[model samples]
Target: MGLLFSKFSSYLFPNIECRTLMLGLDGAGKTTILYKLKLNETVNTIPTIGFNVETVTFHKLTLTVWDVGGQERIRPLWKYYFPNTTTLVFVVDSSDIERFSDAKEELFSLLGEPELANAQLLVFANKQDMPNAKNPAELTEILDLGSIKNREWFICGTNAHTGQGLYEGLMWVKKQMKA
Candidate 1:
C-alpha cells in the first residue's frame, strides 16, 4: 500500500510527504486517534497488526501518521519508519500504572535513534475520564523524557471512547507540520 501510494502521489503531487508517527503502549488510544482521523469514529480498533497509516491535509501540508503498534512484540518494527518522521504522538493509558514502564522504555529507545534526533512528541495522557487516571505532570515524570533535547510535549486528557481531545490532538499535530 505504501508503495502504491508513493507511486500515485509522486505522479500527482510530485513532491509531498508526511512528518509524524504515533506510538505508545497498547490500549493508549493511538488506533482510536487514527480512526478519528479517517472515519470520524473508531468503533473497534483491533490491535494494529503491525502499523497503520492515516493522512490529514491542512494548510497545504500532508501529515501522514504512522500509527505503530504498541505491543511489546510489535515495537521493534517502529524503527523502519523512523527516518521520515519529524514528530511523534506518545499516547499513554493514564489509569494504567503498571504499563508506564513499558511506555518509558519505548520512548527512550525511540529518542536514542538518529532518525528521531529532533522529533517533537505529543504525549496524550489518555483515560482522563477514569478516576484512576494520572495527569499530565505525572506523565512527564513517569515517561522519563527529561533529557531529550529539542522536543516539545503536550499533555492531553482523552477519553478515546468519547473522542474528547482527539481533534485537539490532531490540530496540534497540524500545527507542528506548519512550524
Candidate 2:
C-alpha cells in the first residue's frame, strides 16, 4: 500500500516545485512553523530581522518557503518577494486577541497585491496549545475570511510548539497547488 501510494503521488505531482511565503505579525510563530516544517523538530528562534528561506520536500512536492519578518518596520519590503509565490501561509497568534485587526489589515493589503492574485492562501491559527487560543472558526470570523472571494484559501488551528496541524496545512497547500 505504501509503495502504491508513493507511486501514485509521484505520478500526480512529479518534482513539483512551489514557492511559499510565510507572512504574519511579529510573534505570530511564522519562524517556528518554518523550522518545524524544515527540521521536523522544535527549535528556538529569535524574531526574524529580514527573512529566512528554506526548502523542504513534502510527499512528492518540493516547497521553497520564504519566511519574512512581520514587524511593522519591514512590511514595505514584503512586496519585493511577492512575485511567483504559489502559496501564502499567513500565521496568526491565536492567543493574541489584541492584534487581530492588525493581522486583518496586513492580510487584506497582501491580498490586494496584483502579484499574489493567483496565489493560494493558508491561514494558520498558531499557538493553539495556549489556554486562551482561539479556534480556526473563530479566527476566520474575526479575520472576516468569509468575505474573501475569487481565490483559494484555508484556515487551520496549529500549535507550532508540538508541530500539530503543520503537515495538514502543507498537504492542503500541496493539493491546491496540484489543482
Candidate 3:
C-alpha cells in the first residue's frame, strides 16, 4: 500500500521545474555537456556565441538550461541571464591546467554577483576521460570552493563525451532545489 501511494503521488506531480545556467571558459565543454544532458548522445558543437536554451527532463525534474558563451568577450553578457537561475552549472576543462587561473577568476566574479546570491552552484570538472584531466578534489582547491559559505555548492568530475557523471551532477542540482 505504501509503494502504491508513492507511485500515485509521483504520477500526480510528475516534474519539478528548475532553471539552470551553464557557464565556463570557451573550451570547457559547456555546449557538449548541454547536448549530452538533452540528447543522451554526443553532438558536434561550435562555440556558443551568445547562449542556447534547452529543456531537459531528468526523472521527475524538468530543467530549463541556459548555456551561455564563455569567451572573454562574452563574459560581460553572463549577468543578464542570472536573474532567475535556480542552479548554476560551471564547467571547467580539467585537462587545461594553464587556463585554470582564468577559469577561477571568472567563477569568482560570478559568485560575487548579487543576482546569484540564492542560486545553487554545481561545478563540473569536465573532460575527465582525458589523460591529463584533473580530478574533482584538485578543481575544488584550484577554484577555492572550500571558502564558499553563502550558498549551496557541489563539484563533480564529468566526461561529457561518455555522459559519465552528468546525471550525478544534475541529481545534485535536484537535491539542492528541494532543499
Candidate 4:
C-alpha cells in the first residue's frame, strides 16, 4: 500500500516524512478514518496486518499517516512506528467500557517512551453515533490525558463510516504538528 508513497515522495509529498501514527484495536474505525482522509469509498472493513500507510496532501503538508493494527495479537508491531511519529492518535471504541483499561494501558505504554516525549496525542472517541456509545468526557476520565506534556488532545465523537469528525481529527493533528 505504501509503495505508491515511496514512488511519489520526490514529486508529490515533498517536505514531510514523520507522519502521524494511529493505533487502535480492530473495529476501532482506524481504517475507516484512513479511507475518509483518502476520499475512498467505504465498504467492508479489511483486516490490517502489521500496519498500513496512507498519504494525503493537506495544502503543502503531505501527511503520511500510518494505521497500525489494533488486534491483540498484532499489537507488538505498534511500537515499531511509535518512535519517529510526529503525533500519536489513539482511537477508542467509546461504547466498550469493558476494554477501556486495556486501551489505556496500551496508550500509556506507548506515550511513556522517551522517544515520544514531544509527540502530540489525540484521542478519537469513535462510533459516537451508535446507540450504546459513551461520550468523550467519560472516555477522557478513563484515559486521564492531562499528565502528558505537549498535552494537546481532543475527544471528538465520530462515526467514521459516515466521514463525520474525520476532518476535525486530521486538522487537529496538523495543528499539533504546527505548534
Candidate 5:
C-alpha cells in the first residue's frame, strides 16, 4: 500500500520546471546539443536565426531549454529572455582558438547583467573531440571563470557529436538546483 500511495502521489504532483538558456557563437554546436538532449540523437542544424525552445525531461525534472541565435546581430536580443533563466548554458567551440577573446567578451557581458545575476552558469567547452580543442581547464583560464563571483559556475568538456560529457553537465546543473 505504501508503494502504491507513493506512485499515486507522484502523478498528482507536477515535475519541477527548470528554465535553461543555451547561448554561444555560431557553429558552437548549441543547436546540436539541444536536439541531442531532446531526441537522444544527433541532427544536422543550420545557424539559428532566432531561438528554439524544447522540453527535455531529465530524471524527475523537466528542463525547458531555450536555444537562442548566437550571431552578432542576434546577441542584443538575448537580454530580452534573461528574466527567469535558472541556468545559463554557454557553449564554446574549444577548437576555435582565435575566437576565445570574442567568446570571453560576450560571456562576461551577459554575466554582468543584473537579470542573470542569480543564474547558475554551465559552460560547455564543446568540440572537445577536435584535435586542437582546448580542454576545460584551459578554457576556465582563458574565459576567466575563476573571476566570476556572483553565482556558481562550472566548466565541462563535451563532444556533442558523440553525446559525451553532456549528461555530466546536466547532472551538475541538477545537483546545484537541488542545493
Candidate 6:
C-alpha cells in the first residue's frame, strides 16, 4: 500500500516536507522574501490578493511556503491556509515603525489559532537595509517576542532587497523542523 510506500520512501530518501506560511501586513515584503528564497533573485511584486505558494529546498527539507495577502480586506482569508502549516514566517516592515503595534497584534492573533498551535514561528524583521529600519533587538522588544510561549520562535533581521539574513532564518527553521 500507499502508506507503506510513503514510509519506505521517506526512510530511504529522508527528504522532509515543511509547510510554511509567510505573512505580514500589506507592503511588508512577504512576496519579495518568498521569491528571494525560491529564485535567489529579487523579483518585482505587487500586493498579493490571494496567495503565492512555492517549494524551496533547504537542508533536506522541502518548504512549501504560502505567502498570503495581508491587506485588511484579505487577512481573513489567512486562516483558511493555516491547517497543516509547520512553520509561520512573519515578515515585518521594520522601517515602518508606526505599524509595529499592528504587526504585534496580527502576529499574536495568528499564533492563537488552534490549527497553527504546533507551528514554529520565524519572525523576519525585514527592510533592515533602510536607514530608518529597526534592528532585530528593537523589533524583539516592540513585537514583545519574549511573551510568546508554548511555541518555538526566533527573530532574524533581514533585507529582502540584497538577500541578507534570509538563509540564516531558513537555517533556524530547518533546525526547528528537524527537532
Q: What is the TM-score of each predicted model, taking all chains together?
A: 0.81, 0.93, 0.93, 0.83, 0.94, 0.92
Writing each residue's lDDT as its tens digit, candidate 2 over 8-54 gives 97787688799999999999999999989899888999999999999
- Please report the TM-score between candidate 6 and the true structure: 0.92
Query: What is the lDDT of every predicted structure here?
Result: 0.78, 0.93, 0.92, 0.78, 0.93, 0.93
**Which candidate wins on lDDT?**
2
State candidate 4's TM-score.
0.83
User: Which residue pairs clash in candidate 1?
Assistant: none
Cα lDDT tens digits, model 1, 28-64, are 8888877776676757878887888878654445678
Note each model's CA RMSD in angstroms: 6.6, 2.8, 2.6, 6.2, 2.0, 4.1
As a whole number from 0 to 100, the lDDT of residue 20 in candidate 5 is 95
Tens-place lDDT digits, model 3, residues 65-131: 9999999999999989999988989999999999999999998899999999888999999999888
What lDDT does model 4 reach? 0.78
Clash-forming residue pairs, model 2:
none
Q: Provide the clashing-pair count of each candidate structure.
A: 0, 0, 0, 2, 0, 0
Task: Using lDDT as the measure, name the better of candidate 1 and candidate 5.
Answer: 5
Cα distance off (Å), candidate 1, residue 44: 0.8
State residue 113's C-alpha deviation in candidate 5, in Å. Answer: 0.7
Candidate 1 residue runs with Cα over 4 Å from true position: 1-17, 58-61
lDDT of 4 by residue, 1-179 (tens): 58877878757645544478888867788888877767746756688877778887765567788998898998976778866777777889888878888988988888777777777787889989887788887787878776655556677777788877777877777666656
Model 4 stretches astray by more than 4 angstroms = 1-18
Supply candidate 4's per-residue lDDT for 120.
Answer: 75
Poorly placed runs, candidate 2 (over 4 Å) = 1-13
